[model samples]
Target: MFFTRKAFPVQFNEHLPLNTLIENIVFTVFDTETTGFQVASTDRLIEVAAVTVKGCQVQSSDTFRLYVNPERQISQEITELTTITNEQVAGAPFALEAIEQFFDFVQRNETSCLVGHYVAFDVLVLKNELKRSKFHLKKLQHIDTLDLIGFLAPSFDMRDLEKYAQAFGTRIYPRHQALGDALTTAYLFVELLGHLKDRGYSTWGDLLQVTNSPARHLSF
Candidate 1:
């Protein structure tokens, strides 16, 4: 279905690690779940969710969620992990349609850059599909949360979300929903942003350098 276009609220980015380009800034935090991890072979994306975050707040009204019909059946093993079954997605909208909508929503509302935990892998999956569709999905400015958290809390222990959540005094919820994970990541990202501001990391480039590599931990 060809969408006619709709206006969405502006997302946020002025406070990000970027320099002085503050006008028309926004950011989109997104996540997706598929039949499996490998986007290259048989696995395909089944669900995708995203939210616009501005001023360190998730705009609940400006969220997107969709389930797509995976041409192949989802394995029971994968289903157990994500709680998504092949029947749930059967006859749903096509992958192209869901992605097209997500692409447009993000392009219209998003700024700054796309971000998420383990964002690199997710970006790879979307980029590959967008390339195949010849869609105009932006190769985000790139922010891998695992790297960011490492940079800020060099002394903080535990890399997994469960451990991190305990460190932050919150319980991980909904386990594996895309939107649920995105919400959790959003909270963590804002905390990192605050930490950066406190430490004087005031440019996008400055923040990006640390996150571009693996998270570094301090000994002792």
Candidate 2:
């Protein structure tokens, strides 16, 4: 069943004040494995994963991951990168079904901040897929770890998640998979939150204000 934009009401919890402590805030860290880079063109999502964090800790039981049948052939290069072959997704649910489950998972924590590394790309792909499926996600507040890392370490290469993880002394095993990346980002986010706290960013608003500063010019 396709859900129209108005099918689900925007829950009131999403408006929770941002003045609360950062460690106390709930966060939903997610990642997507897509067919290609361009969301406006032919790219499609093949996999997605989300993990919940609260009190600066990852909740393993609250994780969600799914393989999506893109309804198109998986490219050889993509297969090489993600190790998600065409055969693996042959019986998987299509984008519409998979996204529905994803939405359900997210709605469980309507007020949680959405998080990812290079998050804009993942969010764009998800939004585009929802549009194509005739569904709409409730507007979400997002935190991009890439932007945070860029602000903190201007000289380091911010595009590579592995590099950032290494700098933080975090390990991202089985990299490139959706779940693995999400877990890695969650760890990096926790570490970044510590640095932000040390720099007087105790509230969600404080962190957002700093990351959105004009001087940073963070693209992610």
Candidate 3:
């Protein structure tokens, strides 16, 4: 059954204390493959993937991946990029079921914030999906690895995930697939975290300060 907003209330910890060390913080890194880029209408998710990270390492056992039946035809361009086909998702669960599982997976830790590459798009798609299910996501905190990379390496061209992975030496096996991209984001995040740590940013507050700095503007 699809969850209603009242049934599954997500809690946001945006203002929560961030005194804890980064090493002890739990992060739920995720990625999604969708039918298209238009989040305001029509587009739907075809796949979702997530991994839990702590102490700068991914918990191999703690992962989530789901192929969702988008209920619409996928474009050939999208298929070429993500390699997801209608036949592959024909027998899979629908959006609501897959979203329920994703919520449960991330909600395992209340303090865990979401991490993604160009995360806004993924979040927008998830929000739209939840609205379809008559639910809404709580205002949760998130970190964008793309933004972090921009802040750290301003000279690097922020083109695509492949560029970021190659520049940072993060392995992206089977690129464009949900799980593969999520794993690659996790590795890139860990490396970025190390850079932040070396720059004396050891707590979530410190990281947020940098991310929200007025001087740091992100493009792409």
Q: What tens digits encode model 3's per-residue C-alpha lDDT throughout 1-220?
A: 8543533465533455678788878888899999998856999999999988889887757788999999999999999989999899999999989988887887775445788888888888887887777776555778888778877898887658888888888767578899988988888889889898998888977877767633222111
Each prediction's whole-model lDDT (CA): 0.67, 0.79, 0.80
Better of 1 and 2 by TM-score: 2
Clashes of each: 7, 0, 0
TM-score of 3: 0.88
Q: TM-scores, in order shown?
A: 0.78, 0.87, 0.88
Return the TM-score for candidate 1, rounded to 2 decimals. Answer: 0.78
After superposition, the stretches of candidate 3 with alpha carbons farther than 4 Å from their true spots are: 1-8, 12-16, 109-111, 213-220
Which is superior by lDDT, 1 or 3?
A: 3
Residue-level error in angstroms, candidate 1, position 139: 3.6
Give the range of the ten consecutive residues with the poorest summed lDDT in model 2.
211-220
The Cα error of candidate 3 at residue 67, in Å, is: 0.2
- In model 1, the runs with Cα more than 4 Å from the true position are 1-18, 21-25, 131-138, 155-157, 213-220
lDDT per residue as tens, model 2, 50-106: 898889887867899999998899999999999999999889998878877886787
